[model samples]
Target: MYKLMASLLLGTSLTCAAAAAPANAKPYEHVLLISVDGLHAVDLANYVANHPQSTMASLQKTGVFYPNAVTTNPSDSFPGLVAQVTGGTPAVTGVYYDDSFDRSYFAADSKCQGNPGIEVNFAESIDIDDTRLDAGGTPGKPMTQIDPAKLPRMLVKGECKPVFPHDFVRVNNVFEVVHQHGGRTAWSDKHPAYEWLNGPSGTGVDDLYALEQDSLIPGSKVKTTGSFKAEREFDAAHVKAVINEIKGFDSTGANKQPVPALFGLNLQAVSVGQKLPKAGPGDDAGLIGGYADANGMPNSGLAVQLDFVDHALGELVGALHDSKLDDTTLVVIASKHGQSPIDPSKFQPTDEDPYTKMPGYAFHIADDASLIWLKPEERAKALTAATEYLKDQGKALGIGQLLTSNQVALAYQDPASDTRAPDFIVTVNPGVVYTGGKKIAEHGGSNANDRNVALLLSNPSIPPRTITALVQTTQVAPTVLQALGYDPKELQAVQKEATQALPGTPF
Candidate 1:
């Protein structure tokens, strides 16, 4: 009778816990995630080491800092964020680049200057509709943005209409999962194109405040906050949006709602500041050198940017405290990709288009990563010629390793049957940005430095720890779900692709 009672009690407790579920299990009721583009883990650690009183230093005091987080090998924003959010790689996610090549597409609207065809360069420019009108009414504002019809779109193979963001992604994002379970979601990002962040969800953000960070169009501003160049003030607007989300009102004094389950925004200042020329139009040449660094150190401009980001974090922290949500909210500071080579002197500019030199070749080239898409008939010839050419001029061209598409696909279990897969991925030597320009650093390679990023998960309730384990950004999805008391198995990519949560998570 005693054993029977004990078993009954145990079963009762387990039943109650299952019924209570997320309400009783989760340490955090909300998650605030933000990505800092092109930031490396070493950079953040270096900043913290040098600036003991900095904003990052304060967070580092209580946060679990991962200074050796692994990003996707491609290391571009599109694939990088997908990995972080969905825990799916290029093979499963099928997202190669933000502006990537797709042969499966038949032109819907046909952005081609000539005749429309099956090939399309799917870029961010076409993601938003024409509602984006500049201040002068010329157009290109993300505020009134919708889906555009004029841009080249990948129709549903046989369908003549274009595909939406939801259809483009192969898996569901955290937003849809959380929202489905009665959680509110909100996000603010660089371009309206980032609407893709909603992932596989036909529905867009419940509260979206997209800022045209680099809009050339005049008057194309986020009425809530206007920013120039690198979204200095736009970042402030995101902070405001988050506060508003907690309070239940968007920037537009309408649609009062409940606190969002997930809310955050990306910061562009650091990337822009790091790349900003030391001198403005009238600044002294001596001062110009102060903004840029030879070895990716935090120079004057980058330091200013770092401080600015810290200030933003402080502001957000203060707001969360003011709202009394700090204890219940988990703040994440993550990077989409790390800039390479931290030593900027390694750049080898491609003075001319290398693709043009290859005779008898029909191919499309994404010069940034040296990705070459070859026609089926010309693939063998192109591959041979390209191989010989790179071999002959390896040192001069900065070809670190040129792997065939088959190798990449085979290694990742991705078949080259997909049009999104490139014929050959050219891995340039460290710091070699093949494109000719003033850019000192570039990513989009398999270089470890390019794929190494930082992740900071901070909550006052959790003990501070620094994990040096080999954690990939893909683990972020499952980790996030697990933190929220959602079964990591619910994530399609996690379940289907077998992406595990972060190894050192407190939960």
Candidate 2:
């Protein structure tokens, strides 16, 4: 009888102990997401198979690589980044383009006022009266400039007052979730307009390094004459700043005392001005001269870019290793969009072509889209002519579909606001290269080639393999959440099912 009682008691204790043990004890201590804008899955595969010296190549040997990672619709930087951070689509988040018309309630015009798409600047600084704008503003005082007292009334229904990170995102981002769970967050990037994505506050990023101010030398002959060269020094400085911040966190005991749950280092060099010459060819030398001769490929300016980006990646990876955070950190390398080949012969000023003529036509090949401003009197005529021209070009050049004002408006959920859409929005097709002068690359459209980019994840927790599944940029945020053992569903804005949870992660 004594032996039987002892055996029963011991068995019960063993059962309890087993139940108390964690199912999976390994946890990711940190996450470092890097965006190498314009990187394609094919490029990554080539690098890995060829044993290239790119930092990404080194990571591919042991990391999980996705060869067909797609981005959300509109496929521009704003939407791409939002998807990556919020795990939601454009229909949910409302960041449809680099510059979207303000569709929130307006007080002055009881009727919705359609803004001119070309004139709407995402990076422009505009003054707003919170009260009037919030109240939908009074007649004659448009919502763009409203009084502060009426702010309370104009708030959008079912929407929280814009808060950083959260306001920009319709759903909660990884940082918000991590921070809510008692984790720290930080990020560094080049887009100044990112401030508005989550509103002015509550972005959840404790440390933000954005290049808001243009460092271009004003009135300098180089800039004025369009002779500016890609500045590697500027790129290096941005990287160094990120490294310094990381070091600060480690040295100040921040890493030791509740280390950051999430952090990101954005290297803009790879995507900086698609037309800019890659590093090492010499300032003022065209991109063709930089890598065309050595790579045996057409002077497309991609090789130089690849080499430049690889160097920057190496520097960043080295920094992570030096900090002793490589193994425990989950790193993601991706791009917002891919570049379009630019043929130098396609160089014709807007003034030179009757169809392309428009006011404020600034042709910076590096910009994703060509911005055209038309005089009010010429708006109608210009719109029609441009539409016809684009259609003809689409057929002739084999570029992707050209969006009419109606299509653009319908896509935005407001067809009446078609006037606010770009007079002529051309969605360039894959392999249809546009070139002017010595510039050889460009991006900005809704084409599949431009939308599909690279997404690589490397960490001990993730199994070494390749996922050929169709994944959108929005899935990135939720995947990160799952890796950290958090439920993405808890966030009101994360509508996408967290389907991409990496190997070993509990969904």
The deviation in Å at residue 86 for candidate 1 is 0.5
lDDT of candidate 2 over 1-507, digit per residue (tens) = 563232211111111111111214325777778887766666667656665656777787558787767665556676677768776555455555654443233323232234312223343233232111112222112223322222211245543232222343455567777777777776665433344433323656655544432333334423211222334444554566556545655312234334456777555444544445432323445443212331223233455456666787777678778877777777788777765443334322121122333332312121333323344445555667655655665554444555465655544433234333343445444444444434445555444446667888886445578877555566677667765667756544454333344332322
Q: Highest TM-score, which number?
A: 1
lDDT of model 2 at position 259: 43
TM-score of 1: 0.83
Runs in model 2 deviating more than 4 A are 1-26, 50-53, 103-119, 124-169, 197-201, 212-214, 217-230, 250-259, 277-305, 342-399, 402-426, 429-438, 460-463, 496-507
Residue pairs in candidate 1 whose N, alpha carbon or C atoms collide under 3 angstroms: 129-146, 129-147, 129-148, 134-139, 135-219, 278-288, 279-288
Candidate 1 Cα errors over 4 Å, as ranges: 1-24, 111-124, 127-144, 155-157, 217-230, 251-254, 281-296, 357-368, 376-393, 413-415
Q: Give TM per candidate.
A: 0.83, 0.67
lDDT of 1 by residue, 230-313 (tens): 346556666676667766676343568887788787887676555554533322343321224454576665666677788888
Candidate 1's displacement at residue 114, Å, is 12
Estimate the lDDT of model 1. Answer: 0.63
Residue 144 in model 2: lDDT: 31
